[model samples]
Target: MAHQFSLAYLTVQGCPPPEQIEIAARTGYDFVSLRPIYMGLPGEPNYALAENKELLRQTRKALADTGIKLLDIELARIHDGVDVKKYLPAMEVAAELGGRHVLSSIWTSDRALYTEKFAELCDLAKPLGLTVELEFVPIASVRTLAGALDVLRSVNRENAGLMIDAHHFHRAQDKPEELDAVPRTWFHFVHLCDAPAQIPTDREEMTRILREARLYCGEGGIDIAAIVSRIPAVPFSIELPNLARVKELGYEGHARRCLETAKAYLAAHPRPQAICCA
Candidate 1:
């Protein structure tokens, strides 16, 4: 089967959920990863689909009109003093819109708290038929594959999975071969992008690169094929968020280029049929 592609919210950060769906459809994306659970970043639009019934209605209408699937909702973080239950409304909204996954990350250094909250988040999402996929961000508490694996094993929830972002994998210095040991069942979807080979040491620079300046699939130094080939054949969510490119190409144009490059790269480097070691 051909690898499916998703238009990640970071790719078009300014677009609201409904407009995102329309853009994804126009760009020929099979799916869209939404940001319904707002992060409150500066200048970020508060989609508020969970609170605004009209917004939710419009988002649902966009999906129906364009036939673009809602792949996931993002940034469900397990942080200090966080109430995991607060995410329940977003989970309900995603489920209502036929979304499949909830993208999560650990933002707290407190081990016990993160573990407890992650499990709680998974438990809340279980009934809604959404799998909680944990992404190990370099700037976050769970910054490596091993740390993420430990938490997953400790939580041991059936509805929990792992999300590998190419930028994070490289930034954390994780080897593609290390993916061989991961359970095949934990694989859900992946965040695809590339970046400069010179890994940044400072946290602010790293954060800047992750949120503002990621490269397209084959444009930078990341070994995209090596990392992707080891994971299960899942949808690739294009999370390339280059501010310059967006300014030059516009949202639809940039999204189209991202899809085009990703498709071309995947075609040039086919994945092996059997990824798991068993």
Candidate 2:
């Protein structure tokens, strides 16, 4: 069977969940990811779908009308001053909208504490039939596959797994072949995008690179075909959040380009190297 692809929330950050669902379906994506929680700086748009009943109703209707599934709801952070329990309302809303996973990250310096919080979040999600995927970013505390695996091992939550981002993996200087050592079940899905081989040495610059600039699959330096081949069989979320390009092409056009480029890459690579994992 072919892998199901998603139109990630970042690809059209300004769109509300309902609009995103419609765009995803029109662009031929099998699933769509939502960003109900605000992760960026203030002054940005946040749909806050959990608190908006009417919006959720509209989003659910969009899903039903389009037959597009909800891939995940982002994002929960394991940092200070933010209560994980506060995410429950949003999680509940996402669940109601047919979301099956939640994207999360840890930023604090404290590892053990964050692991506990992640496990607790998993506990809360189990009843809702949702899994928590910890995505590793260059600026995030869990910055590499090794770091992400360590936290997953520490938490030991069946509902928690690591979400590999191709940009982050390349920036971390990790080889795709290294995924052979990773447990297959640890990966529920992955964020697929490409970037230049010249990675930023500064964390702030790296953050900017991830948030504002990313290339569509097969467009930049990342060996996306090799990376996807080495990783376990899982769906790919097209997370190319190129803000400038969105301004040039508009939301629907940009989304169509993303889906088209991803499909082109996949079609080019008909066979993938098998990964051995237990």
Off by over 4 Å in 2: none
Q: After superposition, how far is residue 81 of candidate 2 from its true place, in Å?
A: 3.2
Can you write out model 1's per-residue Cα lDDT over 187-264, one digit (the tens) per residue?
989999989988998999999999999998888999989998899888999999999999999999999999999999
Regions of model 1 farther than 4 Å from truth: none
Whole-model lDDT per candidate:
0.92, 0.86
Best candidate per TM-score, number?
1
In candidate 2, position 111 carries an lDDT of 78
TM-score of candidate 1 on Cα atoms, chains taken together: 0.98
TM-score for every candidate vs. truth? 0.98, 0.96
- How well is each residue in 1-278 modelled by candidate 2, as lDDT tens digits? 67788999988888888888899998889999998887666667867787777887898899999999998989898886567998998899878878889999888878778888889999999899999999877887778888888888888889998888889889989888788787888788989888888998887878887987899888888888877887676788989999988999999999999888888988998644555676
Q: How accurate is candidate 2 locally (lDDT)?
A: 0.86
